[model samples]
Target: MTLLLSGVDSFTGIHPFLLVLAAAGLDRLVGDPRWCLHPVVVMGWWIRRLQQLSERWAGDRPWALRLAGGVITALLVGGSGGAGWLLEQWALGRGLSDLRPAGLLALWIALTSALAGRSLEQAVRSVLQALPDVAAARTALSWIVGRDTTELNQAEIVRAAAETASENAVDGLFAPLFWMLVGAGLWSVGYGGAPGPLALAWGFKAASTLDSMLGYRQGTLLWLGTAGARLDDLLVWLPCRLVALSLPLATGCGPGGCLQGLVAALRDGVPDPSPNAGVSQAAYAHAAGVQLGGLNRYGDQLKVKPLLAAGSPRPNPAAVERMLRLSLRLELLWLLAGLALGIAISAVGSVQ
Candidate 1:
């Protein structure tokens, strides 16, 4: 059972790469639908339900309700990981090879939970296509980002889209993989197999949910959401930097420029209010040779934030396409790295 679990974790770790390939193929075969229901969507649905119930039960006590909601949200997130562990155990006990089609299928589902890949690209593209003339683009961008886009010009629209894409690359792509690696390492040390990749997926989803729901600078929800947001920030710290570094490596930005971009991002990105998001946005903005970060709306509220990167004039539609292409390249690089690591680990274990 132990060997099987370890083998499964090692084998299934490559699922991210395979899934990306599959999704890309799917994208090419059929055009992207504007609305795809992700696993996180289901998670969000349940979280909102819990929040509503909490509010109902503790109508007079906002603090109590917020606390209850936070606790419930954390449990759901952590429980998803435990559930994955059990599933891995069940699969191992059934004598299914870790690399079998069934195992791969499980991994694919788990990777999909990460919510890092194609959907994000499509979302940005949708806004870009609708921009400058379409009211729907303003609404769509409003949904994805906290920025105010009510009176945004074309350049501002492109900057907002680019910024959101770069930030999500950290949260959606790199963070889940970081947790997967952590879970895999722990699994190897103890039970000899990591839980299904879904464990990390659920955990990240939970964290993301909490961050979104309660991670505001003001109001009663601040303290309650602090731990989740901080933990998320810590988990993505390295991965965020890696995402930033990829900007230079993939975009032909030299090391000197990349470092400069990194420093500039670290110094300037801090002004955006999100602890970790600015780093990647700043890096990508510098690498792409465009300026990012500016004033925008969060609902009806206007947030005037400092700019992250200083570069040429505003981005046009072509620049939007370029950013997407760069993002795709970075995604591919990360997927390839994951697969290689998985293969190497499996080979080493086999020899041992």
Candidate 2:
């Protein structure tokens, strides 16, 4: 415990909670800068390059394509963690104490890029800004959601944007921090500057980027995307549930309401077919008392997903805005939880 905190202090030159607060602050204030070489952008380029190379090498065989895809997924996902691990090693070993401030600055920048809170808010807000103009809304929605926004009504657009903000809140914020804390705990147990947490976070980012780029039914990548899609689902499963269950507490909806929200989520979210996305989306819908899913066009095909708030008030722009605010609150809630855990760990150490 002391060892873990000490390792965190050694690595970042600050306490773990402070480190988390700093990272969160940076995420809120400075979203992915257009100027910086974002890690996700780097991963995206790598994925595209691998896709081109693999397609040529694997020929037309379905099995060969799938095999090549699995290899690419493994390499990128594992390599993301390995790269972060190597950076931590380099920073700790070769970087001089006189260079500590520079090292910390670099890490801060890297960690800031890991989160997508403000950027996501901006995305939803973009659609909201383009409102009443269906053409404009569709264009803005295209930037955030995978759905074909051609036939969507204003209410449908609002619901879709809210659902996206809810779902991404887990992927973009909660899960990464959970993994980082785990790695920090591991370091305290005699592991030297446990690189596992940051590695896992970035690795999740890599898998998510791959899934986004390749996981589509109507493409040459249908088979190739299977590994990325499945790996992303696997990585996010637990964190999805955690965020879903915590939504009530985070939003201060009270215990009975929380239980009601969870039950509604399980009842409705269970049938959405997605393992992880449903939980958060459903929880958000139930907690906010707004209907979410319905029939939607991905392209020429129509998907009739389960309606979340059946016979209830539909989400308007105000509700969608509130959902966005809830997403920000969720980040702060996790920070408080992290601080409490640190306090508990320190207390136990003192008793020992």
Candidate 3:
């Protein structure tokens, strides 16, 4: 599906490569623009409002919570797609139905806002700069990580930052792109046709946001958030493995080293706690030359997860930067690979 969309006759009406490059530039220079109007932030606010308003009526009942969650998911995903379609139409109309400056700009904004590579890097860099002051670093890290940072040492903080950054390479970037591509082909052939990449990417974001907000194992969210969490896991499963498999080639790590690290990751990664997180974390831990997945604190509870790359040294500030670099490599590789495949698919479609 992704291949078809990415391959379709200008799936976005803009050259895929040019559109992606523009989006990347946007990510680097304006990333979520702390003060600017942000789509995700707006979605988050709406989700929160809907959930709270429903809670007033749903109370603590499992069915009510679950129902509320379902409603939230539908609203967010549907809303994003509708909004994308509307924007695309406006852009296309303004540009005389051609993918010129106006349409291209709209596409660029949608794709750019969907990515978080720069923002995530900036966040980890903050922790790195705060350094030696574990307290300051922890405070900085807390914004990015969900784990308790109050008792963490410098090493733990760096590890969390690196791990999150590496894992998010897929979440904040690839997975959404994958879906956008998948939707492209469908949009091209569907009734009335649609401008796909933007709509699909935002739809993916809706799912991810829902999982983050409601997908918890404790409290009312335990039962209510189950659907959101599972949906996120299902959508991300393949992308995680894909990223893990390519981590070596993307980072330009030698086969000998990558192979060795992959062995460590397979032995340690597949069995780790998270249903999907370990897949990416394993390759990242090995490629970044850092140890991950030891004991982590979540509030008063301490959980000891399966360790990865046990032979490597503990993560440090250097490891954080290295991991971030590796993640970038993975994102680029995925983009290029997808583009290549898309070209082939588009050719195939044309022949048919």
Candidate 4:
């Protein structure tokens, strides 16, 4: 297990934890630069291209669409993961001692691109900034959420923005962080040329991208999108729960209060159809002392969600701002915790 520390040094000239921290900092400084071709945009293009091909091949047959979708999911996820592994190997081969500055920069940029904390915050804040003016707010909110915003009032706009911010805390931030750590742990155990951090992070991103684009219940997407949707749900499950448990504590709550918060979040979140979304939203709802989850419109359908933090007031602009702040604080907390764990692992490996 000497590889824990030594391999990290050789691979990136620093600890993976530090790389992640730097990447997150970079993301905050410059979110998905508008001038450049973002990786997720490329990923979305590929998904659309593949969907066209799949539709042509599968025709209208339900089983055929399902099969085609499964194949597409496998290919996209596998290809994304494989690309990450190859890029890492090519960049850091024979270790960073060789002093490949371009390679190191590339790795940092890739890592930064994978994280969406800043981007998500910016989007939500855009909606918040458009507040009180229902038309302007709806226009801004339309860009971030799937709900019909045309009929939404100011309070509903605030609730929708709050919900988007909370739920995406899992998708846009925590899940990628969790996978990168997992991959780093695996690499330290002597798994060379395996996923490692970047590969696993990109892979999770690919799955998330798939679900966001194709995972719908309407028409052909019902069957054709199942593979991507389920894969995203599976990948996000552990991270979502981790966020639910830790997010409350990050709010400066005492141990007993943290436990109560988790219990309350779970009690309310469990009833939502999504395994992860409910818990995440509920966690933030309770932490912010605001209610979330209510009627939402997706295209032509209107759906009602179970109320979380039932006795609390509906989220206002203030509550939404608090939730965003909480997200930022929680991110810092997780980064510190991950760095501590990495150090502990390295120390244990040194002893061995």
Candidate 5:
């Protein structure tokens, strides 16, 4: 832990431009893979398995299920993080320079995999290409979104694809980076290198997994998933809103549109059930001059959400592409900012 912290602190003094260049290069080389067993995926599978087992034991006991789920969630999160930290420490002890071109290579790969930008772009592109055929489009959209796409029209398809892009910008990109920063800071404090970040990432993955598995409002899950859902919501609050605000800069929406979109989103998005999703969706709708929010079905359940950016232009396949482009830009901007901040802190500390 001490070595990891010292290494991170030492590496932080490197130039920002160099750090970003290295990270970006590594990201380009190690794009997201469909078959790769990502930590999040593994964690999710374990969580679901736990939930199922708990249900079997607890039966209809709502309180017992919830309590068990919470305890399990904590253990999974803590355990994964601890293991990741240990692995990171071992990797660093192998004498990897924290900021050398080669050192940056591994870090970059880690960051890129963490971001999931390429995977998201592929998902959006698949939806865009499928738009000419409604059935194909529905299938492709289903790959990325949780809703039923069968009933969607062209506009709705566009809206759904775009909304997913915007929302994922926070979840897939900024959220991980935020925790990475937190972990890096801890490393600087002498805890160790990437363990802090890895642990944080694992914790989030656990929370996200719980939300996905048991977070639904439906039967057998509402109580069990409530705590996990709320914790995930709380964890993502800042990143979601920050990404929402940054969308304008990322997508070329301009300050005026950004402000209007945020306000409009606030007015219209508040009615939606998710505490955090509306921030980005509303902002994107406002910025892109599109109206989003309407009836959505998850399985047999129908949810009528309040419209964000009401009366904006209807969306099309082109709109989906635009949203994808914007999200990519925003993610890149975030990456750059993180690199800059990390380098700045490292330099200042070194100077002192």
Candidate 6:
């Protein structure tokens, strides 16, 4: 089940847990630097190119379009994972000792590139900062959400912003973090020949990008995007649940609050079409004591989302701010938990 690398165990002087911490810190400090061609951008480019190619073959045949989509999904996911594997191999080479500074830096940058916590925060905050001027706020919100923002009132604007912040917290941060940790654990436990953190993270990113761009329920995308959308849903399912459960603890809420949040998330999120977004939004809505979900417009197709935290009040800028802060707190909580687990593993190894 695992691909054993050539001299896989030869790489030394690097720990993925440490890299995760370093990456999180660097991401918080610098956000995503746009000076370089970002990995997500590359993924987007590939999606566009591949989709065009698919169109040539698919034509007006629904069945053919669906088949082409599946092929494209396989190619993109495999390609992204392969890219990650190569990057790590190039960095680790025979060992970190040989590459030293360059190797470590490369590993750190690669891991950091997978996270978007800081960027998510900045984006949500931008909407808040542009508030009081409804139009400016709408413009800011438009940058982050797919919903039509033109006719939104102040409350709706705030609600949309909060919803996006919560949903993306799962998509942009926790999901990738979860995969990276899994990849790190596999590598650290001596599966070096297998896909490492970057491989898993980038693979997830590719799926996510596909869903965002092509996974629609209407028109041509209805059947063509099934594979990509389902793939993303599967990848996000566990992480979304984990985030929902741990969010209360991250906010320093006691057992009672945690239980309530989980219950709310399940009750509200289960009914939504998406396997993940509803749960994420519900958890944040409960945690922040704000209601979310209502009528939304995506390019003139009006859709109504199920209300989350129905008993709660509409979110304000302050509520949105609380959610952002909670996201930061949750990030730290998970990191600390990972640190503790790493130490326990080390202690057991020493005993053996």
TM-score quality measure for candidate 3: 0.86
| Candidate 5 residue pairs that clash | 1-191, 4-192, 4-193, 5-187, 5-192
Give me the overall lDDT of model 3: 0.73
| 176-276: candidate 6 lDDT, tens digit per residue | 99998887776666566778788899999999999999898776788778899999999999999988888999777876777777888999988888889
For model 2, residues 1-352, the per-residue Cα lDDT tens digits are: 3433234333332244555568779989988888889999999999999999999988777888899989999999999987776554444442234235655676666767778888888888999999988789978998888788877888888888888988888788777777766654554333555674556678888888888899775556878889999998888888877777778876787766666666777888888878878778888887677888888787778889888767779888888888887777777887777767666666665577
How does each model score on TM-score?
Answer: 0.81, 0.90, 0.86, 0.94, 0.86, 0.95
RMSD of every prediction: 3.8, 3.4, 4.2, 2.9, 3.2, 2.2
Error of 5 at 1 (Å): 7.2
Q: What is the C-alpha lDDT of each candidate?
A: 0.64, 0.76, 0.73, 0.85, 0.69, 0.85
Q: After aligning candidate 2 to the native by TM-score, how far in Å is the CA of 215 from where it should be?
A: 1.4
Prediction-by-prediction clash tally: 6, 1, 2, 0, 5, 1
Better of 1 and 5 by lDDT: 5
User: What value does the lDDT take at residue 37 in candidate 2?
Assistant: 92
lDDT of 2: 0.76
Sort the predicted structures by TM-score, highest score first.
Answer: 6, 4, 2, 3, 5, 1
Candidate 2 segments whose C-alpha is farther than 4 A from its true place: 1-14, 92-99, 188-190, 255-257
What residue pairs are clashing in model 1?
A: 5-193, 6-192, 6-193, 147-297, 148-296, 148-297
In candidate 1, what are the lDDT values of residues 118-177, reduced to their tens digit?
Answer: 667777888987866657777878877876678876667777888887788678766766
Report the Cα lDDT for residue 324, model 3.
83
- For candidate 6, the lDDT comes to 0.85
Better of 1 and 2 by TM-score: 2
C-alpha lDDT (0 to 100) for residue 177 of candidate 5: 60
lDDT, candidate 5, 1-352, per-residue tens: 4565554433333332343445444544565766766777777778878878888888888898788778777777777777656555544552335335544445445545555666777888888887689889888998889998889887788778888977786677667666665665566444445565655766776677678777887777877787888888988887777766677786666766656555665676667778778776887777677877888888888888788887887777676677777766776776677666666767677688
